[model samples]
Target chain A: MTQARLMDGTALARRIVEETAKRAADITERTGTAPCLATVLVGEDPASVTYVRMKRNRCRTAGITSRHVPLPADTTTEQLVGTLRELSADPGVHGILLQHPMGPHIDERAAFEAIAPEKDVDGVTFASFATMSFGLPGFVSCTPGGIMRLLDEYGVDPAGRRAVVVGRSAILGKPAGMLLLARDATVTYCHSRTTDLSAAVREADIVVAAVGRPRLIRGQDVKPGAVVIDAGYSPGNVGDVDFDSAVKRASLITPVPGGVGPMTIATLLEQTVDAAARQLGV
Target chain B: MTQARLMDGTALARRIVEETAKRAADITERTGTAPCLATVLVGEDPASVTYVRMKRNRCRTAGITSRHVPLPADTTTEQLVGTLRELSADPGVHGILLQHPMGPHIDERAAFEAIAPEKDVDGVTFASFATMSFGLPGFVSCTPGGIMRLLDEYGVDPAGRRAVVVGRSAILGKPAGMLLLARDATVTYCHSRTTDLSAAVREADIVVAAVGRPRLIRGQDVKPGAVVIDAGYSPGNVGDVDFDSAVKRASLITPVPGGVGPMTIATLLEQTVDAAARQLGV
Candidate 1:
């Protein structure tokens, strides 16, 4: 089988990060203030911890200052909200990044809502989601934002195309569909509530598998010459798509480790710099 | 050929208006205040004038008060913004409807932005569009809102379904896709920019045609047993989808005059009442 062209997300992400670093340095040198990103994390899930550390390390490398706020696993919703609200009101903090999957007990949405819309660099707030979905100028969820960049880089124009997104998570599926719809692509969303999966996947010129089910999407189900993006993250780093099967049918496909993952951090850093520039008026 | 079952929008509209009128009267009597809608029109396009007049007349029939603001054709963007801002800040104006098709010279987005997000009853603002797209609690664009209501009334569950929306007008296509996406339907948006419209249409379990083209979608393009909504409008009551051919394939179909048209007015009135309640804190 002829292999599909793999989208080099890592390379693109590196370029984006480098550009962000330069901008950060410029902003710092000109204004005597570095872009500041507040990283909020609740509970120390090993993966979440690693992700937070990686983000901070990346921030330091990009010349952006990082403010770490590690809350206890038993942090009350009020405590988290107060902390976020304080960060939101602080002039020193231009952007706030609240790591996801805080804890089962935490009111995730409520805590997210506490971060001011202007400082919501993580793009998790209702206001940001709405703006992103409407195609209005606003911060976007990192992974979904990265996905669009990949599509654009690959010369996959969404205008008047059929894009089927398999997932319905609030942060992922819904926003992804909204983003594509904004670009004039016909977008469809499937989820646990959906009765049929394969039939839906078969009809797409563009398929975005974000449901986090490992190998839920198979190659045979993909139409010839279609573009496939697997944003799902599994324990072994397996994507939602059956890469072995999908590559044969897909004209362009995103591989898990090399594709979408890298773009998330890139987008985050870029937004941090943007927020800083706007707030500092530099 | 079997005659298509015409979905009667007129009758449906009458019932909805009647229900809205009763609720409006009850709310007014209880609170010593009636629902109030603010209508802002720039320049006197004959069609726009007629539409605003019709909406105002309906508001009166429902016992809702109407506030009308008329601007000359040469009104500058700042002047228009100033006028809209006054209406937005007024506590008595529960809902604001900015009559569309403003003069070419006008900054439409700027004007729409003047209306507070809460009073954007017409759902034209970026905030409203974003909120609608996110499936969050916010006012919806009238036609798309009506379409979803009709779908629910007809028991068309969008979850896990392939929904193709043919058109990408800001108020219609974009918002419709977001609404469908929120309901978990995989929605694809197709428009003039689309390369292959037929293939996209054929895959839809639910199709919404909002392009103002008359009879553009043929019956052969529709999937059998799909729910079809024709939201297109022309001078002489023409629809976007070719009704005659589409009916043969669609399990349920909304007729042009009797389907989506009535729902727009209904949704408008419903939102006006809702706005009144919220503003009045009742």
Candidate 2:
């Protein structure tokens, strides 16, 4: 069988960031104030630091200002929440991002709730999730939003399709299913609790592998002509899906490093400018 | 073929209401304040009036007081929002219920957002929707909450199950899917935009019919031994699933008038009491 056409998220993301830069420039000129994103990170986890720095670097290229708040590993939930609350009330901050997995004791959800919906550019708030679930106009969680954009870019219409989302993390799998559901796709969620994962994957017209296990989805299990999205990434740039095996079965597939990872930062920048425009009334 | 066991929602609701009434009475006696629910009705539609009256009547029977706010058919969105804002600020009103289907001119979502999350017992606010999506501690939309309770009452464990939800309305299908996802069930949302509804239904281990269509699901499309929940309702008390056909193929099913309907009211009363207890600190 012929190999599936690759969904080039990296190329799409680059184009998106370029467009966002122009919009940011226009907004700054019109309002005399540039878009600003405040990122708070607790502890110096290497991965977290790298992700935050990457985002800030992208913001600089996009003509947006970035504020970084690094807290100690022993920071309490109250301190974190207070810091986020201040950011929420700050008129200069158009967007806020609190890096995930903040130590074991700190209440992560509480910190997310502290960010005002208007400034929730990362779309991690309860309001944004609900709006996405209802298919109303609102900022979506970055990865899921980027995935939807990628699908639209590739002309993969979700309307009436059987789309199976493998995994159910709050920011990824769950919201992804809701977004698909809103677009009129029949969405199924599979996770660790799923009894027959392979059987469920075989029936999908569109398969989203986001369980974070490298090569979890093999080629033989994928339906012929299905759209396979490997949203999972392990250390060393390995994706959840078996790329070699899946490519033979799928009609379309996303490759590691060049797939969902890059799209996330692209969506974050796009939404930041959108938020800034709204806040500035430009 | 053996007939499915009919799940009795009326009996379950009566039991639930009794417990709610007792808790409400105790709280009122201790705090010297009765539980109060603010019912905001827009326009003079007969069905809206009837539903509001039914809720108020039930509140009275459960020892909860009702505060009514009736608006004109020509009421503008700002005026409606202002009224809701005033009610939201009132300390006496422990819970707020905005009857659905406000006039087309009014922005219903804006009005719903006006009600503070603390008083949004009906779970229409954006915050409540997000909390439900995240599986956080917050109230849920009544019909969806009731349907979940019915499933639990019938011993239908969602974990490791494949749940296919038919419909995508904000208050019903969408939230129902989220609740199921929270419990680790594989969920699929099907709606009018879906191409092959029968095939989707046949793959479900559990089916939630919330499209309000009469007899939309037939037995031929049902998987044997699946748990079927019919949340649909028509003018003549008709359910979405064809009872005669579905009963023969399912392991359990909920009846129309006595099923999801009663649970909605039960959940309403329960949330009202919980709100009152929190506000009064009893």
Candidate 3:
């Protein structure tokens, strides 16, 4: 059996970052203001810390500056909102990214809303989500935004395709489906409430597995020659799709770690520069 | 052949309006201030004029006051936005409704965003759209809100059902699908670009025909025992669904003229009263 071609997100992300660096340099040279991203993390969650650190490293690579704001785990929602508001007001901070899964007591939506719409490069704000849903020009949720870029890089036209998104989380599955729908794809959102997930998967020309369930989608469920994008990252680096079985059936597939993960930070850095250019009026 | 039961949106709308009337009266009696809905018309489009007249009549019946602001066909976007902003700030105005398709030159989104989120009874603002998409607490687009009410009245639980939403207009189709998805229905959005609309519709337990093409969904496309909601309105009182044929196949269906039409205005009035109550602290 002919194996499916892998969609190399790592290589594509590198190209994107390279292009973004050029734009960042141009902006800084013209305006003498380096694009900066402010990442606010509440509590000392080890995973979040690591994620923030990785993003900061990518910022450095792309000629963007990073500012870290660490709040105590017991910080009040008002305090978090205040810090986000300050970052939003700072002309130096072109993009504001509030790391997710903050303390349970913190009002996540309130914190997200505190970030000015122009500075919400992470695309967690309601304003950004609205723009994405309406297909208007605005920053997109980084992972979903990266997914679109990857599709574009692979020369995949979403128009008229039957795309089934196997998740409905606000940031990932919902926005991803919205982006596909905006591109004129016939999109289906299947979640835990879906009675027959396999049946839906079989009918898809493009399958996006975004639910964090390791190997939830089996090979038999995949349509032959389908484009499979496994956006779900579970423990042990396992994806939502069973890679070994899916590779034989899919025409194109994204590997777990090197697929959506790299594209996300690349999108953030790219959008950070874009936001800076817009703010600096360059 | 067993004919499908009609969803009877007219009767439901009447009930909804009656309930809204009581709420309006109670709020007025307690606060000594009647709920007021300000309708802004950009141009004297006949359809829009008629719609505004009808809405005002309903407001009168519900004991809610109506304020009309008419602009010429050559009105600038800034002028329209200014009017909306003034109404949004007015303590007397509880809800704002802007009649759409405004001259094709007006920045409709700018005008919609001018209405305060608290007074956006028509639910056209981006903030309202985001709240609806995320299943958060806020006003919903009137027609989509009415569709949910109809579903509840008929004991149709959207959870776990296969729902196909045809059309993806900002107010109607998109919000309808999002609302269904929020209710745990596996939702598919099929538009003009869909490769096989019939096939997608045939898999749905609940089908919403919102595309304004007359009789686009035939009887054969509808799943047997499916609950069909026809939110489309075309010339000659036609709907997107072929009612004569679809009624024979579906378990429940809505008529073109009497089904979704009344519900739209009813939702607007109901939300107006709700907005007034919230604003007045009554």
Candidate 4:
């Protein structure tokens, strides 16, 4: 059996970043201001810290400035909201990224709402989700946005396809399914509560595994010649899909480390520039 | 074969309205002010005018006060938005309903957004959509909310069920699917672009027909013993489902005119009172 062709998100994300860099440069030269992304991190969660650092590095590489706001672990929700409001009012900041899972004490939704819609580049706000759901012009959640780009790059049209999304998290699976639905795909959302996961997977022409369970989707469950996208990244560099087995059955597949991971930050950078351009009226 | 049982949305809606009326009376007695719903109608479209009148009549029946703000057909987006904002800010107004299909030139979204989230009882704003999608504490689109209540009334547990929603409209199809997904049902959204609509419908344990097409879903398309909620209304009182055929196949089915229509207004009145109670601190 022919092995499934790899959907190289690394290569695609690189091209996207390069294009975004050029736009960032053009905006900077024209408006005398480089695009800026404000990264707000509350508390010292190791995973979140690493994610923020990586994003800041990407911003630097893409000719965008990064402003890091490191809040104390015991910072109150009101204080955090106040800080976000300041950044929202700051004309210098084109985009705002709030590193989440903020110690479980903070009102995450309230914090997200504090960011202005125009600068909500991370797309965590309610406004962004609504726009994504309605297929209107607005920023998108990064991981889902990247997934769409990957599909576009691979010439996989979602129109009229039966796309099964095996997750329903706000920022990831939910938005991903909505984006697919917007593209005219018949989209099904299945999560942990789903009674028959395998039955749903078998019917999918496109399967997006995002439930964060390593190897939850196996080769036998995958329909022949299906397009498989594994957006879930567990510890130890494993994805939600049983990649080794799935690749044999899938027509196209995204690998764990190099697939969705790279596209996320790439999308963040691209949206930052897009926000900056719009903000600067360039 | 035994015929399908009627969902009886009209009876349910009457009960709901009675309960809402009691709440409205209590709030009015305690606060010395009835719950006020401000109905903003843009343009003189005959259909829109009729809808606004129906809503106002429902408000009166539920002991809620209705304030109608009629705008001329040539009203600009700015003027309409300003009127909505004023109503949103008014302490006397507990809910705002902006009757839509406001001319081709009007920015409908902007108008909807003008109503503050607290007063968005119609659930037309982006904030309400996000909350509904995320299963958070917020008002839902009236039609979708009524559909959910119908399911609950009939003891149809959505959890572990397969729900297929045949529409993608912002207020109806999209929110209905999201609501079902939030309830832990594996939800599929099938629209006009769906290649095999019947196939998708056949797999559904609960089907929501909201595409506003006449008899689009035939009896054969519905799975035997499925719970079918026909939320669509076309010309001549026809629905998206062929009532005669679907009633034979469905285990429980809602009829045209008597089903979702009355429930929509019932939900509106309920949410209006809820909003009023919250704002009045009752």
Q: State the lDDT of candidate 4 residue by residue for A51-152, as single tens digits.
A: 999999989999999999999999999999999999999999999999988877899999999999999998899999999998999999999999999999
Q: What is each candidate's DockQ, to 2 decimals?
A: 0.44, 0.82, 0.94, 0.96
lDDT for model 2, please: 0.91
**What lDDT tens digits, residue by residue, belong to model 1 across residues B1-282?**
454455666676677788888888888888888889999888889999999999999899888899998888899999999989998899888999999978889988788889898988888877677677666688899989989988887777888787888887778987898788788776677888777889889988998999999998999998888888999998788899888789988888998778998889878988898888888877
Show model 1 residue runs off by greater than 4 Å.
A43-46, A71-86, A103-116, A154-161, A182-184
Best model number under lDDT: 4
Per-model TM-score versus the true fold:
0.91, 0.98, 0.99, 0.99
Model 3 chain A poorest 10 in a row by lDDT: A101-110
Which scores greater on lDDT, model 1 or model 4? Answer: 4
- State the TM-score of the second chain for every model: 0.96, 0.99, 0.99, 0.99
Tell me how many clashing residue pairs each candidate has.
Answer: 14, 1, 0, 0
Q: How well does each candidate reproduce the native contacts, as fnat?
A: 0.64, 0.97, 0.98, 0.98
lDDT of 1 by residue, A4-54 (tens): 999999999999999999999999999999999999999889999999999
Query: Candidate 2 DockQ category?
Result: high
Tens digits of per-residue lDDT for model 2 on A50-125? 9999999999999999999999999999999999999999999999999997789998888888999889889888
> What is the TM-score of candidate 3?
0.99
Model 4: fnat (fraction of native contacts): 0.98
TM-score of chain A of each: 0.98, 0.99, 0.99, 0.99
Off by over 4 Å in 2: none
Q: What's the lDDT for candidate 4?
A: 0.95
lDDT of each: 0.87, 0.91, 0.94, 0.95
- State the lDDT of candidate 3 residue by residue for B1-282, as single tens digits: 999999999999999999999999999999999999999988788999999999999999999999998889999999998898999999989999999978879999988999999999999988998899999999999999999999999999999999999999999999999999999999999999999999999999999999999999999999999999999999999999999999999999999899988999999999999999999998
